[model samples]
Target chain A: MNWMTTIFYFFGAITVLSALGILFTRNVLHATFLLMLSFFSVAGIYVLGNASFIGVTQLLIYVGGILILMVFGLMLTTKLNGKALVTENHNRLIGVLLGTVFFSILSYIIIFSANFEMLKSNKTLPENAVEFIGINLMSNYLIPFEIAAILLLVALIGAAVISEKRKEKQE
Target chain B: MSTIIFFLPFILIYTIFAVYGERKISAFIQDRYGPMEVGKYGWYQTVADLLKLIQKEDIVPKKASKKLFLIAPVIIFTSIFCGFVVLPITSSWEGTLTQNGVYFLLAIVSLDVVGILMAGWGANSKYSLLGALRSVAQIISYEIPVTLSVLCVIMISQSLNLQEISYQQGILINAFPDMENVKNYLFGISALNIDVTNWGGVFTWNIFRAPVLIPVFIIYFISTLAESNRAPFDLPEAESELVAGFHTEYSGFRWAIIMLSEYGMMLLVALLGVILFLGSWNTPLPNIGNIMLANWTTGEPETIAGNLWSVFWLLSKALMWIAVQMWVRWTYPRLRIDQLMSLSWKYLTPFAMFLIFVSGLWRLLMI
Candidate 1:
């Protein structure tokens, strides 16, 4: 295989391993860190696939933004009582069942719906993909984009109100 | 790959000198002689310190998480170093020619937050944990203003490529005939009949190209100061309150690595600021009437003299900003955490948002 294929496999392996690590790791912080690894490697895979704008955005939003906040929340909530922070696994059977079902559905969709010929063809994206993506977002995907943005705004306001109420109760 | 080869040694040499320079600058500010005995004018003091650090013991506390503790500095250094990959050093020499280069750089550099958190949490020290939390909060909050200000530049330049942004600031506008509208206006003023496409200098820079960007530049600088954890926004490492902050428990070469990354970050932001606002790799000297100073200073793109001039201009501008950062650090007292938060969320963020709106209007006018 070529260098690109080798790099793609490398990132893919890291993504899978990190996700597995997250599932198996007892320490909540370790699991969270592994999740970051998973997200980062997924971004790498996106870059490898020529979706560089999406890859960078994934890094920006997921690893840099969401993961840091997740780590912050975990750190603040965990008691600093000089003990290793660990979480107990519960309802393993049901969890396994649900995970398997979702995985199977995703695999089935990929196997049946996705064009394997297109994957093999390896068509490179436009040179100015950022501009292309922006135009598409503004014109073709504007409604979906606006809807998602509004949903996020609503979630943000709800979070603020909920936290404000908590402070009031505490006072 | 070649850029990485060049930058690795550059970073090493830069860190050594920068440490010494910071000491001398701080000493001068405080009216004290800093490290006069180590070398000629204390030139090799930081080198001596690096040697000492190398020889010292690598200490990991008994309660520390061994794996994460061991890996934290590596992660921090790697993340910061990766940011250099997207930066263009000269006209012909860029690390990567990615379309979304600035976005990629910003995103990768921010990943150092995870590494800082790892260092703190893995250290199992109260001081380290507190410092890390403060740092994460400060960096993340300041990032909004930084991103918005950068977005202002991207909107004005209409490209996310750092090299493209750099080209827009120089006499190279002739190479792109599509920028005819830009060539027609001098400093975005249609009333000014003079065309400045051939006059490469500060006049062609983004701040002057669109004057609304001046405040945006200021906001960017302030926020980047906080993003890099420099004073007066350096509550994370306020020595008085949190010892040495997130790396308090780290010792020897590990601590040195952390210091190296900190300086690297400072240099990174300064370089980025220079590229985004000031003319990147372009001579500030304008071609005045009957004198082609700008033309003389900025050599052709591929020639040896041109490459040397480009590297010189970019580094000199970036270093000037670094000197400013050090000056600010020594001059101002560290901000209180609450005050820092308010400054970022209450003032800088809101102001940056407004600037983005203004930038959009200005861009419309330019069109």
Candidate 2:
């Protein structure tokens, strides 16, 4: 395989491995960090696909922003021992059957997809992709950015109120 | 100039220097010498710290999740390093071997939020978790102002590419012989600009040409401090209360990673200050020849010397901003988490929005 193929395979393997690790990890905190690793390696896939902007965004939003929030949530809400947050499934047989079927379907899709030789080398950052998003965000899609801000604002206030509810309740 | 080639070492050196400088400056300000025993006035203190950290045994507490513990510091280090990929150092220098440099940097900055969170979780420490959560909230909340202020800059510059933005800035518009007589492309011989004090003398720095840059300057600098998780916004890692904050559980090399990453980020943000607000590599005025002939050579940058001079000018400008950050770090006390959030969401965001609106209006009015 060419160097490009090797790198691609490496990132892909890492991504898949991290994802599986997240799924299997019983420890809640461990799982969240694993999830972080999983998300980052997928971002690596985006980088390989020449979507560095999206890749970085994926890293920023998922790995940096979202994962941190999730970990914090896990840590704050859980007991001193982070491993105590485990919820063992009583229906292990059904869970295993369902997991196996899902894995089978996923593997079948991946195997078929691999046969297509979909990889094509394009070195230069495709112009209209990265700059165009920023342009569209400012010009055409300005309303969306504004709207997203508003949604975030509402969520912030809601989260704040919920956290502060105990103070009101006690008073 | 060769994109990644110029700034890769700079990122490493800046990170190393920031830690070294923070200690040295802090000690100096506090009336004591700091870490001088390590290496030449503590020049290699951070390096010694790194060696010590690496040699020290790794600790995974019995309560900690082993896998996540292994993963957390790597997460922190990897994500912060990503930011260097997009930094435009000089007018020519880009850290990444690509365009869409701004996007890359923005993405990388965003990733630090995750690192803090992961560190908290993986350690399974209460204080670490608290620090992590607070950080995530603080960073997310502050992101609004940061984005809005950057938006103001992007709107003014009309490009997202860091190199292009700096290159356009590097132009010595006032250096042109008939610069004063030159008509605006959008506006006619319009109302002669109010503040042309520097026009006759200082030549074409960004401040004079883009008046919006001044408020954008204030808003941008404040937002940069918040973005870098520097004091007063450093509530998440309040040294007094949080017990070393989010990376509290980290010892040895893990702790080193966190410290180095923080400094690297400080330098990155400072570099952004120089590139965005200050006339990056471009001298405040271009026509030093005129100044030299008139025996006023002090005002003009030393472009007559060589490329080395321009590099010096660029580094000097960047260092000035870094010093400002250092000063701010020393001067301010940490804010409360609530205070930090309110400052970003309530105050800074609205101000940035208003500034952007006014700037856009002002630009249109000029036309």
Candidate 3:
């Protein structure tokens, strides 16, 4: 295989393997780190696909910000005792059956979709995707962009309100 | 890959010197000679320390998460090295991976937080954990202002490429033909229009491009100081409070690697400030015909002379900033945690946002 294909497979394998590792890992901290690896590998795939901005954004927001927060939360909540953070499985047979069915359906849809042919063809992105994105956000996609901002503002306010109420209740 | 081969040795040597410089400067500030015994002027002190540190036993506490603890330093050091890959050292000397260089650097830099968190959590020590949490909160809060300040410059430059930003700063701000016309100019009263033909060199730096951006530049520098965990914003790693902070449990080569990475990051931020605000690699004077300063002559980028001068100027500017950082670290008392958070969220953040708005308006109306 060509080098591009090899690199693509390498990223794909890393993404899939680390995601599975997260599911199987007993320790919450180990699982969180595995999740980070999975996210980073996905970012690698995005970079390989010519979505450089999206790739870096994924790395910055997911791996850097959100993952750190997750790990921080885990570390703070856990006790000092070196306990193996394993959870007992309930209804494992049902979970396995449902998971298999879900995978089968996903693969069937992917194989038969009309967009499959188009996905096979490689299309080069614009040289200045960031500039294009900025112009589009300001022009055609202005409404949705503003809506996203408003949504984020609402979330921020909600979080503050909830936390303030908690503090009052504690007092 | 080849860049890494060349860069590794350079960074290794640089970290040694930087460590020595930091120690000597701190000593001088405290009214004492630092590292006087090791070699002439203590230049060999860092070398000796490195040798000693390398031979020391690598100890992992029984309670520590062995895997995470072992990998934390490697990840931290590697992430810093990864950042160097996109740094536009001299345009020609830049690594091949320069696409969206600023964004890439930001991403790589943020990865260090993850490494620090891992180190703190994996060590199974309360001090390390507390330091990690403080670092996380401080870095996250400080990052907002730093990003906004950079965006202010980026808004004006209209490009994410470091090379492009540096190239835009080439135009001189020499409104006056002669240097003697400034006698009557007092209290910021001068009609200095940006002149592309006559290079006013240092005056074309982003900080001086517009009056409002001066605040933005100051805010950026302050935020960088906090981001890199330097004083007076170094509450996270306050030695007296946290006992060496997140790496308290680490020893030997692992601890040395962590220190090296910290110095690397300090240099990284310094270099970014140079590129973004201080006019990267551009000399103070335009190339005067016939009578040139020989080795210090500015050349068109990509030529041999240009390459040499670019490295020279950029390195000098970055080193100057690093010295300032060291000076500030020694001079100021560490801020309290509450004060640090307030400085970031209350003052720096709001002011940065205002500066961004004002700079945008300035660019729109004036430029």
Best by TM-score: 1
Models 1 onward score TM values of: 0.95, 0.78, 0.91
Better of 1 and 2 by lDDT: 1
For each candidate, the alpha-carbon lDDT, in order, equals 0.87, 0.67, 0.78
Off-target runs (Cα >4 Å) in candidate 1 are A90-98, A120-122, A165-171, B176-184
Instruction: Pick the winner on TM-score between candidates 2 and 3.
Output: 3
| Clash pairs detected, candidate 3 | B172-B200
Estimate, for each residue in B40-93, the C-alpha lDDT of model 2 and write its tens digit.
Answer: 787777777667878987777777766667776776666667666666544334
For all candidates, state DockQ relative to the true structure.
0.79, 0.44, 0.69
- Colliding residue pairs in candidate 2: A64-B114
How high is the TM-score of chain A in each model? 0.87, 0.73, 0.87
| Superposition error at A58 for model 1 (Å) | 1.1
> Of the pair 1 and 3, which is ahead by TM-score?
1
lDDT of 3 by residue, B1-367 (tens): 2245666787888888888888888878886554765578877777788889999999999999899999999998888888777667664565544558888888878788888888998898889988988987888899899999988888766678776666555532222123222221111123444343333365556665555667888998999999888889877778898997889999999999998888888888898898888877667564345444422456655689877887888888998899999999999898889989899999999999988887777666443
- What ranking emerges by lDDT with the best candidate at the front? 1, 3, 2
